[model samples]
Every structure is written in structure tokens, then in C-alpha cells.
Target: MGDRWHVEVDRSVCIGSAQCTHLAPAAFRLDAAMQSHAREPEGEADEKVLEAAEGCPVEAITITLVGSGEAVFPPEE
Candidate 1:
């Protein structure tokens, strides 16, 4: 829990891999439509959230720090 993070799953890009859920169950879950949804944005550790984002093969997960709106996982470079 390094900082408050906002985790967003791009439904258009999510391919039902459920990798995010496996990496950080508390932060993500698949809906009935098989789209990944952010369950508890604050439930998982910051590192886990980052891992979930990095593990997404489709790169659907986008994590931003609260207040600052800084993209932490993707590394906007």
C-alpha cells in the first residue's frame, strides 16, 4: 500500500485472460460479460496492482495515483 491508486480496466482491450484477477484478486474481477472490472481499487497492495497491470497481455490495466493522476504502471515514456 504505497499510495492510493486508481485501477482501470479497458473493456475494449480486455480479453478475459483474468490475469489481473490472478495477480491481484482484490483489485480486479471479470463480469458476466467477461469484461474485467475494477472491484476494490484500494483493496490490493500497490505492488500487486502494478503487477496486475504489467501482466495483462493486452495491456488493458491502467493504474494512476490518486490526486496526482500519475500513471504508475505503464511508465509513460
Candidate 2:
């Protein structure tokens, strides 16, 4: 998983909707703070990860290439 993408959730922006957890259970988990976190971004496929992020109501999840630090989800508009 060294070369795979990484996921991060902005705690301030997250609203504990649990949508990401529901969409990609293997990759996401609810933390003690009741925020969604990416347990293993590679646990699911790229598309699945993307889908989970897309379903986040607060748009708190952020996906990026591990080495490049480039944003993969919530892409610039």
C-alpha cells in the first residue's frame, strides 16, 4: 500500500453523517470523535473510495496520491 492513495478527513468540516462509513466500510471507520476516517484507503478500490467521498454530505473527506500530495477528491472547480 506504499504507492496507493491516502485519505484524510477534516474533523472541523465533518458532520458525523457516517455516509463514508456506510459506503465504504472496509476503508472507513468512525473514530472516538465520531468522525469518519480512512482506515485503509487501499482496502477498497479507487472508485469505491471516490464514491464514499462523493457521498460525504459535508465534503470533509480528502483523497490524495501518497507520494505526490495531490488532491484526488473534491477536485478544484
Candidate 3:
């Protein structure tokens, strides 16, 4: 099976900074409620999308690989 990524955002923690949107415009976007949301990319997954999740100050974004169920996150500092 082809590789796929599942992205999710913790709306409770999203601060509307729009940083995710700025970083990965194709993967992250703002909803009608001004909440941040992570969507599956149309084609191949971009490393920058993961970077955006890492850059989120609130750590609200998370990315997981489908099937394998592996997840990635920014290092805790």
C-alpha cells in the first residue's frame, strides 16, 4: 500500500497564531472558527509539514503515518 499521513490539530490548544498555515499552506489551514486544522496532503508528504508541527508553540499539531501508525513530533526543549 502507498504511504499516507494523517494529521490532526488539538483545537483546544491552538492559539490562532496561523504559524502552521504560514509554514505549510497546503497541509495546514484555518477553519471558519479560526481554529487550526491539519489535512492530508494531496500527493507526497512534505517534510516541511512535519517541521510546521514542530514549530507550533502550543504543540497542538500531530502527524501519524497511516497503516504503520507511527507518529512524529518535535523534540521537547
Candidate 4:
């Protein structure tokens, strides 16, 4: 996809699982506290990033279109 996306990791909901990091090391990272964070808040849409969000056990990872602000993961209901 050529579109851009915005990624976020809800630290409060993250459990230091590192699933995001494991799935998309280029898109996600874990601090010393093990809390997950988006490597780039906004970047080109990537399949690995989506995979990381989908694989998150707590669903802490959220992704949306950068310009449209449309939900990309956990899709709009």
C-alpha cells in the first residue's frame, strides 16, 4: 500500500508482551520497562505493522490512516 498510517501503542494496556516488537521490529519497540511504542508514529503503511497490531494479545496496538485518520486495525465497528 502506498498510503501512510499512524500507529500507537497504549502503554497503559500493554503488558510487556513484546508481541508487537517480535512481529514488527521495524515498526515497534520495547523500552527498558518493556512497554511497547511505535517506532514511527506516522509512516508508510506496512503489512508487518498490521500483523503486529493483530497479534497483540491485549489489542493495545492501534493503526489509522495518517491523513484520513481512518481506523486500520481493530477496524471501525
Candidate 5:
């Protein structure tokens, strides 16, 4: 199995601006009801995921390394 990343969003904090969708379309999607949700990135593009999280106005997105269970936000910067 591919190494996975766990993505969580505090929907209450999300303003539905869809910035994450635009920044990392491969890692995020909006459902038919327009609810934002996470999808796995197509390889080691954790940076893209991090960008989406940072781009979120409300900071609703949180990314965790699946195997290590470590937070990937604030992205090593």
C-alpha cells in the first residue's frame, strides 16, 4: 500500500471558499453538496497538501503523516 496522509478539516471553521480545492485539486475535492473533503495526493506531494492547508483562510485543514502520525502543518518552515 502507498503511504497515506490523513487529512482533517474543521468544517465549522471552513468558510467554503474552496481555496484548498484550487491549490491542491488532486488532494482535495468538493462533493455534490459542496462540502469540502480530503483525497490522497498522487505521491510524495505533501508540499501541495501543506500549501492547501496554509491557503485555507480559517486554517481548517490539518494534515498528519499516516505512518508516523505526525502533524505536517506549519510545514517544516
Candidate 6:
């Protein structure tokens, strides 16, 4: 079994960049407003998901551990 992750997109900071969708199609999608959204807020941790978060132009995507709430993408500063 793999670790679970919680994915989130900050719409307010998001710039409708399709980078995430392009990077992780199975994990992200764009709505009518062109805002990025997580296909699965909580799901098995995946390399593509991490890639998507890293590719987000505005750094709007955030990923964290499902159980411990530990930051995954941006990491703790």
C-alpha cells in the first residue's frame, strides 16, 4: 500500500494555467472558469501529482499527507 495525499488548489491564486492538468491529467482538471481542481482530493500519493504541484505556475497547488497534515509539495519553510 502507498501513502495517501491531500491535494488542493488555491483558486484565488490560480491563474488558470493548464500546467497541472498537462502534468497530471488523472489528478487535475480545469473547470468552466478555467480554475484547476483536484480530481481526487485524497488519494494515493503519486509522482505525477507531485510533478503537477511543482509545475503549477503560480504555486497554487498544495499537497499534504492525508493523515498527518504534513506539507508535501511546498514543504515546511
Alpha-carbon RMSD of each model: 1.9, 2.7, 3.0, 1.1, 3.5, 0.6
Off by over 4 Å in 3: 41-43, 74-77
1-77 per-residue lDDT for model 6 (tens digits): 88999999999999998999999999999999999999989999999999999988899999999989999999899
Question: If ranked by TM-score, best first, what sequence of candidates would result?
Answer: 6, 4, 1, 2, 3, 5
Instruction: Compute the lDDT of residue 50 as modeled in candidate 4.
Output: 96
For 1-77, candidate 5 gives per-residue lDDT tens digits of 55567788777777788999999898888877666788753236377787899999888888777768777774655
Query: For residues 1-69, what per-residue lDDT tens digits would candidate 2 score against the true structure?
Result: 344678888989998999988888888899888888788754323777889899999899888877677
Top candidate when judged by lDDT against the true structure:
6
User: Model 3, range 20-51, lDDT digits (tens) per residue?
Assistant: 99999988889988889776633355688888
CA lDDT of each prediction against the hidden true structure? 0.83, 0.81, 0.77, 0.92, 0.77, 0.95
Candidate 1, 74: how far from true, in Å? 0.7
lDDT comparing candidate 1 with the true structure:
0.83
Residue 1 CA displacement from its true place in model 5, Å: 12
Model 5 lDDT-worst window of ten: 39-48
Q: Which portions of model 5 miss their true places by more than 4 Å?
A: 1-4, 41-45, 74-77
Can you write out model 4's per-residue Cα lDDT over 6-60, one digit (the tens) per residue?
9998989999999888889988889999899998899998999999999999999
> Cα RMSD (Å) between model 6 and the true structure?
0.6
Error of model 3, residue 9, in angstroms: 0.4
Worst 10 residues of 3 by lDDT: 68-77
lDDT minimum window of 10 residues, candidate 6: 49-58
Q: Kindly provide the TM-score of model 1 when superposed on the true structure, using C-alpha atoms.
A: 0.87
* Deviation in Å, model 4, residue 18 alpha carbon: 0.5
TM-score of each: 0.87, 0.82, 0.79, 0.95, 0.73, 0.97
| Model 1 lDDT per residue over 1-77, tens place | 35687888889999999998999887788999988998865433477778889999999988888878887878889
* 71: Cα error in model 2, Å: 1.5
